[model samples]
Target chain A: MRRMLKLLPIRFLSAALIYLVAGITLGTLDALGYGSFKSVHSHLLAGAFFTLVIMGSMYQLLPTIIGAELKHRSLAEFQFILANLGFISLAYSFLSNYSFLKVAGLIAFISFILFAFEIFATALSVKDFYRRSLAIWFFLAAVVYLVVGSAYALAGVLGITSFSAARHAHILTLGFVAMTNFGGLYELFPMLSLKKLHSRRLGEVHFFIANIAAIGMFLGFPERGNLFILSSLLFLAGFYLFAYNLTRTYFSKSHGPEVEMDISARFMAYALAFGVAGVTAGFTSATLGFPGSFTHVHLILTGWVGLTIVGAMYHIVPMLTWLEKYSTKVGQEGVPLIQDLYNKPLAKALFITLNTTLALFAFSSLLPALSIFAVPLAIAFLVFAVEMLLVLGR
Target chain B: METLDVRGLPHSERPQLILKKLEELGELEILVEVKPVPVITMLESKGYTCEAEQSQGVWRVKIRKKQG
Candidate 1:
């Protein structure tokens, strides 16, 4: 059981890296005047890369945070298998055969349902009221989004309902991916900074606002009605509040000697900045009746979600590797510090290059000449993938 | 016996500090704002015994060296 628990996260992370590389390659090719691979690229990155990482992290961290053992371990393993098969098939559907989407969507939907059940059961099994932190709330809500989004996608694939692809994307991206990130930051910002959250009440408010706005946007998006516009504005407000709360939390004073920020922490900080920028771009595009445009989508996916995942992997991969490889040797023999598990110089280079290139990529939407940045952007993602693999190897 | 308060220490630093202190004292108690599950897991893997209780969002953990 212990061994399985230790390796589960690593397995998911390894798969996510593979999808990340494939997704970036397709994205870069499209940017460099290759055939349109938009559907395939989005599926591999968002459906596979982001979703897999979130699953891995939740499987690893949720039990620890809730002070309970993960419920239905075997189910989680099975879900992982189905999730990969589903996503891989879904990505292939975009490239070759549309009929494959029915099987793919069904598999993905079932996998997420199992995940939701496992996570919810684990949380409910724990009775500690205080253990139900802001992160848990966000995670639970994101699970709801994941299940709903998958169902919506499946319906589209089966032609059971005429659903807007844009709506499906929003549900999954904002509702599932962004919500998970919100929860993650709530937990990680405090842990990383050695400070208690700046304001739990404010976080609660942000949660409500965000969730309500998400529903409102879902209902309003297809029609582009007043509700959609209102919801978008509300979401932007909630995001600002979230950004403010976490920033204050990260910068809050600690009791001990001040510690310098590490590469992982730096990645998170920059990712938050990108998140703010992405949402702003989204808001402007939405109000201008051009929501989900090339610029808006890239800013949100590549700039915000992509960077955040990379930053988080920096912390999670090393910590898990340390536990799996070195924990037993502690006190009996010397082991490398967790931070030393990954190459620092390469991480720094990835950070600087990825952020700069992503910004250029976003601008490239408006200025086509800047599309040349896609090659460097792809290289940065490749480096990130390699770095994570190296960390696991160590 | 010594009680180390790790209420505001960085997460990364807490395990190292506790390990250093435990090596010196052989047994130690820790006061932390959050349950240090990873630290406790690591200690147990290192052949230490840990007992923990929580009150008012604070965790008090008692660690003892492995019996020879």
Candidate 2:
């Protein structure tokens, strides 16, 4: 049972890396005008990379937050296997335009349903739900979005709904990925900074605003009018609330000198700032109805979601590995902080390159000549993957 | 019995605050009002024996110095 549980986080992270490579390769190809693999790229980014990574983190986090064992361990193991297989099949089916790959969608859908049940079964078991942290609220809400988003994807796969790939991408990316990131930020910002979260009230406000914006934009994007602009404003507002609360918390008095304030913490702050820029870009794209509207989505995906995840893994991977490896050595030997697990200079370089790549990608839509950024972006991801592997090696 | 309620704390601070209180209390018998289930292992690792029960929608955990 314990073995099964351990497999989850590792497998999820591994799969996420694989998906990231695939997603970036596909994106590079599309940018270079080889083929418009837009749907495949979105699926790999939203489904394979983000969703899998978030789910993996939840497996590690939920039990710790609730102070209990996760319910349905066996179910989770099965879901893990099924989800990976389903994703591969689903991606292949979409990439090749094979109708047979629809079965993969069904399998993935079942996996998500099982995942929702796993989350609720574990989370709801807590006696007092109200005392649960703000992160739990966002995490549970993300689960709801996941179930809903997966259902939407299934419908699209089955041809039962007119839900376009673009709409599904927004729902899954914002509704699932961004929602999870928000919840994760609430917990991680404090943990990494070694300070309590600044304000629960503001966090609550951020949650509602972000969710409203996500749902509203998902529905309003097609119309591209007042609703879209309003939703974008709310989204921007939500990002602002998070930025304020997190920054305030980070600078608030900590117990002591914070554990060297790793590159992960810096990355998180950058991601928050990027989130603001992305939302602003989104608003501009919506209001102007620009010919290069795709830039906005690229900004959000790479700037907000991509950077945040890469940054988070720096802390998360080391923390988990330490628990597994050096936990007992603490108080007995000179145990290193989680920050020491990874190369800081590499992390900073990755952050810089990633942002530069996103900026170039964002402009590439406007000027196809800017597509030369693809090589640098690919190199950034390669550096990131190698750094992550090195961290795990330690 | 002294009681420290972690209900109002953020998730990140709850465990830290609880651990700090336990360290300060040292040999005293204290009732920690927390989610309880999550802190049991940590408490046990620190040489404290604890038993938790839920009452009125909150967990009440009784902790004392471990008997040799």
Best candidate, DockQ: 1
Q: What docking grade does candidate 2 earn?
A: incorrect
In model 2, how large is the Cα lDDT of residue A269? 77
Expressed as tens digits, the lDDT of each residue in A89-167 for candidate 1 is: 8998899957587888898899999999998988888886344688999999999999999899889878898889889
In order, the first chain's TM-score in every candidate is: 0.96, 0.91
**Global lDDT of each model?**
0.84, 0.75
Interface RMSD of each: 2.3, 7.0
Q: For candidate 2, write residues A166-260 as lDDT tens digits.
A: 67767777788888889898877776655778999999989889988888888885666678778878888888888889989878886554345
lDDT of 1 at B7: 74
Q: Native contacts retained by model 2, as a fraction? A: 0.12
Chain B superposition TM-score per model:
0.91, 0.77
